[model samples]
Target chain A: MSSFSTAKPLKKKFTERLKKDFKNHWQMYLLALPVIAYFFIFNYAPMFGIVMAFEKFQIKKGIFGSRFVGFENFHRFFISPFFWRLLRNTLLISIYGLLFSFPLPIIFALCLNEVRNRKFKKVVQTVSYLPYFISVVVVVSILFDFGKANGLITNIATFFGWDGGAVISSAKWFRTLYIGSNLWQHLGYNSIIFISALAAVDPTLYEAARIDGANRWQQTLHVTLPGIASTIIVLLILRLGQIMGVGYEKIILMYGPSTYETGDVIASYVYRTGILDADYSYSTAVNLFNSLVNMVVLFTANFISRKVNETSIW
Target chain B: MMKRSAGEKVFAVFNTIFLLLLCVVFFLPVWHVAMGSISDPLKVAASSGLYLKPLGKPTLGGYRLIMQNSTILRAYGNTLIYVVSSTLFGLVLTILAAYVMSTRGLLFGKTFALFVVFTMIFNGGLVPTFLVVNKLGLIDTRWALIIPGAVSAYNIIIMRTSFSEIPGEMLDAARIDGADEFKILTSIILPVSKAIIAVIVLFYAVQHWNAWFNAAIYLQKSRNLYPLQLTLREIVLQATENSIIADADGQDVMIFRPLIKYATIMISIIPMMIVYPFVQKYFVTGVMIGSVKG
Candidate 1:
């Protein structure tokens, strides 16, 4: 239709729209220039370099010039004895973290919500959130100090006639110490979201429950929990998505040779092999495997949550 | 609002006890560390149990030792520089990106937003990121810490959300008066966006302070450039093994280990602790906006 009669007019209209659009928003583009370039170089560039996992990385040869080893690095990672140990430890630690460390904040928030005393509630919330800001190094050091044979917590245990000797270094105690400290650190801070959701609950629902002669527990069960259910499910799905990606800094700080049985995670392993030991290609392959699994699990969780509960981050 | 029943009163009593215990559990460690850092080194070593108060008269020996240590001093300076420079640089990038994206008529906001969000879930792992930094010749340089994490995509999205909440009429009024994008941002947007700015700066500063892994990797050969956390970690690692060995018989090692370790921990965290209460309110709101809005 535009071949002869309307082609000229349509072309004119398109160019005019393009010119007007650019004229109006050139300043926005100018502002976005540095951000685009920064992301391009820092984020996208490293993404392209993920290929080094399949290649022999050499300093002199750089990424492209290096010889492609085709699955050799991945092969070594898969066949190595450390592979299964690493995988087992990573999975166990993640699962332990998911099991024990996940429900804490919700419970804390729910409990805090039930408190009738305003001043006491504020104090509890403020005091509880303080630990969240302490650095991982300091957090672990506190653990180490308290877990020493004659340290505070150990002494407390001894006072109660229980053995707490060298708990930090014991393999069996590693998961407990790690998850417990994690619970101590993040429980209050993470509860802020649920607390905010609680604060947003409709007042009419509570009044309605009260008019129906519902007790506090019944009201909480009927009105409060359902009010924040979507928030709970969304947060749960988000947490589940990253079950494989525990923060490695605290683990690295806390774990020792003796406790590696329970403590070594994928990130720390990657740090050891890739950065410390300089096995770049092999570690890259290992990390890529972890990341791919995380990506798949994350999307699967999101999909299932969306389909079942109609709640998701997206 | 109604009168409390017996069952409700029982539940409230139990809840109060539980929350009080929870509060003490969270607060006791920090209190103990703070108290122990100032306690006599010999007393700390010999006590072998909790001290509700300083034992054998508090001494400044531990802090004095940390202050005199050149490594700790240098790391302190390095951390300060990293925190300030990184916060400023990151804020600029974040604000610029967020403002542009929040603009009503940006050509491809959705495409750009997707580009940023995709990096959140998928990325090059450790080796590839290290390789990129190595290729850029940022290894062993201060720029390594400042450049790699300069603009957080999540923070940008949060700031964008904040900026978009600024009414369109405000921006349009400025534009009609012949202000350019930069002028409009400085005069109209910046003046009203203080809350988000303060929150982002605090967040970035805390992140820079807490970060050591990046510095450990990028500044592998440069001990002098190591941040405070990295230096503190080294001390803790060495002291851990030494203390375990010393627990067998060596009194001298035991005397100094906890003192030095606790002193270092307190020194590292003191800044954040000092500023936390003043900025505490913003943190809750900031986190809520980021999480709920996202």
Candidate 2:
């Protein structure tokens, strides 16, 4: 009874403190007003509209006025033939990326750390990051040029008496082209995080390894790799979180009707069926499904990271 | 000096060659396109090997065609307007939000941060966002391009991380001098946080400059308001169709289409390439500190 009575004063005191702080920092509140308004209107407003996924949406009826049809849209999506195709393509491309592009950055950072020439290292870094800044349209254009009959790559292949048709048009080559270009564009930029992790490794550990008669390879294995293991794991978990998400913009720009079998992912499917066709309820249902899968995978990865390594992004 | 081991020597040589080769491979494709742009159109079309240089007499015909194209000019203007307005608006919101979140005595700062970060992990996705924009009557307007993507949660988080690093004593000193929160943010905090500001501004600028998806979706009905990337997309589509596949027709059209496409790509990317080196030094520090801490 005494503790319960004391809680009233504590609650009153907390409110009084909050009031004082607000009064003192009214200008801060004013500064934050526009930002708060932006998020509410732009971010939160759409979140509220996610309810449209369950609705039979009509433009005149609006989001709230539309009739709710629980699970019907999801049921429709689940039964659709495109579902398996999009799911397969999205997963395959993401897995291909995970297998290939994920390790290249780590290896690049490790290789860069071993280089003695500072200027040479800087040049390589600069040139490699150049493609990351290029627009998706331009990257696709460059890829098209390379894949074209008389383009550089095609011409080089033809020199070896190989068929030099447009590589992008072939369904079989879509995964290779997409993943290869991604590696080219992002390898250096992604390596920055790992490079920083490498830089943060203790010099004393390297000296100790040298004293122990460990060669460069042994030092890298025992000392350098261990030093960046947590960072690698952290980044790996983050990458796994994005396993369902692919660069739909590049795919949309590059894919033709011929290659749609391999190139169409959930996002591009959403764009086609939702935005292009204006199937609001159906697309929302599809996108909601994508986001849920992403969130579940993300949490699972985080859970595993926390359990195994005691490090996870919360 | 102690003689280096043969194993170390071989490894060093192998590593150098590998890095240099990787650098060349990364650089050569873009370089090839740039050279193709300036090469004589006829020679460019006829060449079978990799384009190492301008194939024959160099001409500015491709560039001249681009300059004379009114659609390209209009797209350039549209892109510039979008980049400037969006960057300014975003930077202001980001800095102000970060400052408030970083404030020492701010009530409910954690709540506000959770509100922001929640959007990063789970959004309403593309359809709902489009519907919201449509209902707001921003659909086909310039605001459609600028308003929706104006404030990114990642940029806000990164900016907040930088702001929190500011010394508490400095803000305390300003408070002691009776300066208002707004005054301190503008006069004191911003001046000290130039590096982060530059980084965030560049982030916003690059985003706006490269954005065509929103334009493709929101302003699909409006061609006059299409950004540079969208215009480039149309140009390339026509060029590819005309040059690569439609070969039985006009030979002269084929000659210049590849050049036109390459020149357009160059023109679109040249501005970013110029600014990239100057800002490259800031990127490592800015990105590392911003992301790794978060």
- Cα lDDT tens digits for candidate 2, B28-58: 8778878888999887767754677888988
For candidate 1 chain A, which ten residues in a row score worst on lDDT? A155-164
lDDT of 2 by residue, A1-314 (tens): 55987999989999998999889877878888898999998899989888989999987899879999998999999999999999999999999999989999999999889888899888988887888788888888878877776666666656777673767677877888899888888888899999889999999998898889888999999999999999888888888988898856888998989899999999998888898899999998998899889879989999988998898886
- Write down the DockQ of candidate 1: 0.67
Question: Model 1 - which docking category?
Answer: medium
Query: Over the full model, what C-alpha lDDT does candidate 1 score relative to the true structure?
Result: 0.84
Per TM-score, the best of the predicted structures is: 2
The whole-model lDDT of each prediction reads 0.84, 0.85
